[model samples]
Target: MSNIEYQFSEDFAREMDKKDPLAGFRNEFLFPQINGNPAIYFCGNSLGLQPKNTKAYIDKELQNWSELAVDGHFEGEDAWMYIRQKSKPALAEIVGAHTHEVVAMNNLTSNLHFLLVSFFQPKGKRNKIICEAGAFPSDQYALESQVKFHGLNPDEVIVELAPRQGEHTLRTEDIINKIEEVGEELALVMMGGIQYYSGQLFDMKSITEAAHKIDAYCGFDLAHAMGNAPLSLHDWNVDFATWCSYKYLNSGPGNISGIFVHERFADNADLPRFAGWWGHDEGQRFLMEKGFIPMHGADGWQVANSNVLALAAHQASLDLFQKAGIKNLRKKSEILTGYLEFLIEQISGESGVLEIITPRSPSERGCQLSLLIHKGGKAVFDSWYGKGVVGDWRNPNVIRLAPTPMYNSFTDVYQFGRILEQSLAEFA
Candidate 1:
């Protein structure tokens, strides 16, 4: 949406909603209530609102378990043993990978640790890792622990790339230059697909190419990018990636996470990984064999059996995603986020109090806009929260608002603007 064309009025928001192709999706989710009224939910980046059909999906699995008992694992079309496979198509579509390249499994941190074991091969003098300076704490801990596990000093082996002085986001050129400067010593290049705080979407394809040119594996932690942004992980040649479903995927809080390994590693059974029975070939799995023959493709990385209930919830959300289509969702997302940005910019005018730290370009961001409050930040956030404006507040001053295309509407953004303006006046 053009800046000049956006207006800060209810009628404008309503008209935009009327024209939105994905507008019906808003009713598919059950919004949280505040004083018997539905909230203006803008926290999908943190935890997406629950889908209405999620209960029915879970109930089916519950019924299966009750009626079939031990037979549940092998019985019916939605068999427990193959439940994870049900999510592959939707997940692959979301992340732009082949079905064989993706799998829903452990939580993000565990999957990160597992993928690091296979990808972060630090040998000889080429034993350095590169990542963003202020990555999410879990990622920081995972990298540090992994480096230590390999008997390397995190300080010397893990190279953190920070934004330039007074800058809120990293430049792609600087990232490429760092990859070149580190050169032979860089063993791996791992970064968040979209920085959780700033909501800056990195140029993954360019980063992957640069890392490959340096003979280093490149991967991403897509906690914020999985469903919020458009990705082509396979075409970009990313070595591996992992993400949680609780956030944009809306599977449920702290639910299953997914991983994407390039097709190049699909048939490479010799790849080092901590394997379990579930990852073994199904034909030989029940034999209780001594040799671990892993299933081909990303399924080989699974360390345990599928989480049936979680997968059921995940499949419910994925089914919605399949029906709505990622392409269509992304289209609505751009305009919804753009509209939110426009409203925020209008509110911030001459106040110098509310500042958007997220990238201005639509191509460089997803649904999220990170607002850096210069004054009375927490108080303003508290006021908004009290008034039923559901947004995430980062430590110190940032307010992250994600107008998700799956459930949020143009009117939601408009309502948030109204609440924000009142809060700023009373607090800031």
Candidate 2:
């Protein structure tokens, strides 16, 4: 939390918004409507609201495809063949890597699978993988299947870390301790950059260091962390990582994902990978070489051609990020999330129907706060939704409210607090 004291009033929220530097960005997105009014949207952790410029970006590519036909691949300033390069500058900046270290490519899980093939080399006895216990199911499935693909038993080879009993989130000390305890048997330490359910931003830098101490490779699934949290993958000495664009990146649903490979791996063409023609060196790409001849850095991991249309939509979002600057957005994110946390605590105090499971410290969280419903569960979520508050409901009991700093205002958090208060009154 910041040094500023918080108050629970609509007037205060508006005053904060009035003074907020990023408040004008709220008009850049098209929010969902309910009863002809914009719903208070706090679901950016799941799917970000579309930027108003998205359609124009996508339509430009459609026009190129229609006019140029097959020649679109090599024609125009933004050639379809080199579409991936357009996102590299912003992606590199966002992830804290050199331009060559990052590339926009496959979807999240596919990129994970590709990265695992290169990074998760379990030799002899050093075959165990460590990850958070309740990682998103896609990750769980990917890890399980990867172990199985290697002819190893998932139970014996995959180590799932959990929070201490009765605790909502894992302590960083415990994570580092476990990495040390696992020792030489750990082949890889892969975990979410931010634990999805608890909204806990793990100490990724410390985790990476601990993993490297044991000669283990470290990677992160940044689906929930990428644009929402500040990252320094290269500086942290992280080996690899991947993230979906649809969430904080605000690209369309199921859009292209990206990867970060530390610069040390830039020219290591001998590193085993699943290669496609796109990953071949551009100089001899058209010559149809006999050998794979992988491209430099993260581009070598590509297994297919660029998805031009998707890249265009992704470019639109990345452009906004470049313009706003991630550092600026992060500054606002901490305060906005802090404001949400303060308001939730007030409501939780009065109703006692919910408990905030997200860490109270802004340093330990991003744009999201997760509320554990003690009583009404889905009904409580439904009531908030009925009143035009759009938050995300995870199974059994958690409601995730993410006040994205790019477009969400202090007033949105204030309005959500009012809706939550009313809902808790009815449900409690």
Candidate 3:
């Protein structure tokens, strides 16, 4: 990954694409058109493009519902009763968890709250929570409410680790040191697997081990990491985790979220949780009994029955992941993103027109590069938008671009480089 071989030419981009083993995957997604041609879409960090098969997947479920109604639960080709099970294996593979430890249910924040009810148990003096500063707004709200739920002040009970002075990303050593600094008071250590804005990928294995050393539970909000980066949640001994499928997973907006709980908690029925009938033991669920006998594994945390249509849409993307493999996707991501980085540097030259806030090392980031534009600001971003470049803007100054491996190409990166050069000349 040192000094990647890149050229700012369409022929070079096309030749590189021809060498790509995963190039065929670009055809599987539908992209938005700009001026009678596909626009350069580098905003996958915010929302992934829809898979072409997604419509067919949802249609099958809709057909079953039309003909069978309630009987669709027991009757269809993909029975609604076992719809979650169908997605389990594929989802488990993406997150590197055992089948029973992964379940698709609820949205990201809701799943976070449900997981906190069990993992965020604050006792006596060990009531503090550790997280990165400037976490996604939903996570910030969830942490604030969870702390307040236990009758503790968030300012005192929550320890937010910030980058020292002028740095844009958190150092791994700093994160681990903060965990030790909090020591006995630290009840839980939670962070985004990859920060949404800076796009730094944290070392989950190291973080989890450090938390365990301090006798605290550890988990991650994998919203930006799940399909974008390779993860071994179970092997990392992560206590609990959750992720939404819309961004990197390419599921529709507000689609189902997945959760992972280690096998140690698989049969610990005494673990307190907010339960619904779907979470109860399947055999006894219909008996309508008074006492709640939770199901074993992550399924025990589910609060409602499966959403067949949404799961169907999710399964379509999972199928592609199964076919393409996370390791392979990550391999290409490094090259694609590195090319974007190289082109950006070449465009800015030594004038310092843009600064990449994300880590320079490929190992420390996914496909995203968050650029701090020095001068043109939002007007420059709007000019790029006019030219059909689709990178997202993060208030004030930063513009984030993600050249996703699944649907984006080397050609997209090349076009982006050319358009950016034009925009900088015009705006700067």
The local lDDT score (0 to 100) that residue 354 gets in candidate 3 is: 81
Tens-place lDDT per residue, model 1, 15-117, is: 9889888889888999999877899999999999899999999999899988999899989878888888889999999999999999999999999999999
Model 1 clashes, total count: 0
Candidate 3 TM-score, true structure as reference: 0.98
- Give lDDT for model 3: 0.92
lDDT of 2: 0.91
Encode model 2's per-residue lDDT on 266-345: one tens digit a residue: 88987778888889998899998689888889988888999998999999899999989999999999988888888888
The TM-scores of all predictions, comma-separated, are 0.98, 0.98, 0.98
The segments of candidate 2 whose C-alpha lies over 4 angstroms from its true place after superposition are: none
lDDT of each: 0.93, 0.91, 0.92
* 284-338: candidate 3 lDDT, tens digit per residue: 8889979988888999998899988999999999999889988999999999999
Q: Flag the better candidate by lDDT, 1 or 2.
A: 1
For model 3, what is the error of residue 31's alpha carbon versus the real structure, in angstroms, after optimal superposition?
0.5
Residue 280 deviation, candidate 3, in Å? 0.7
The local distance difference test score of model 1 is 0.93
Best by lDDT: 1
Window of ten residues with lowest summed lDDT in model 2? 343-352
Residue 375 in model 2: lDDT = 87
Clashing pairs in 1: none
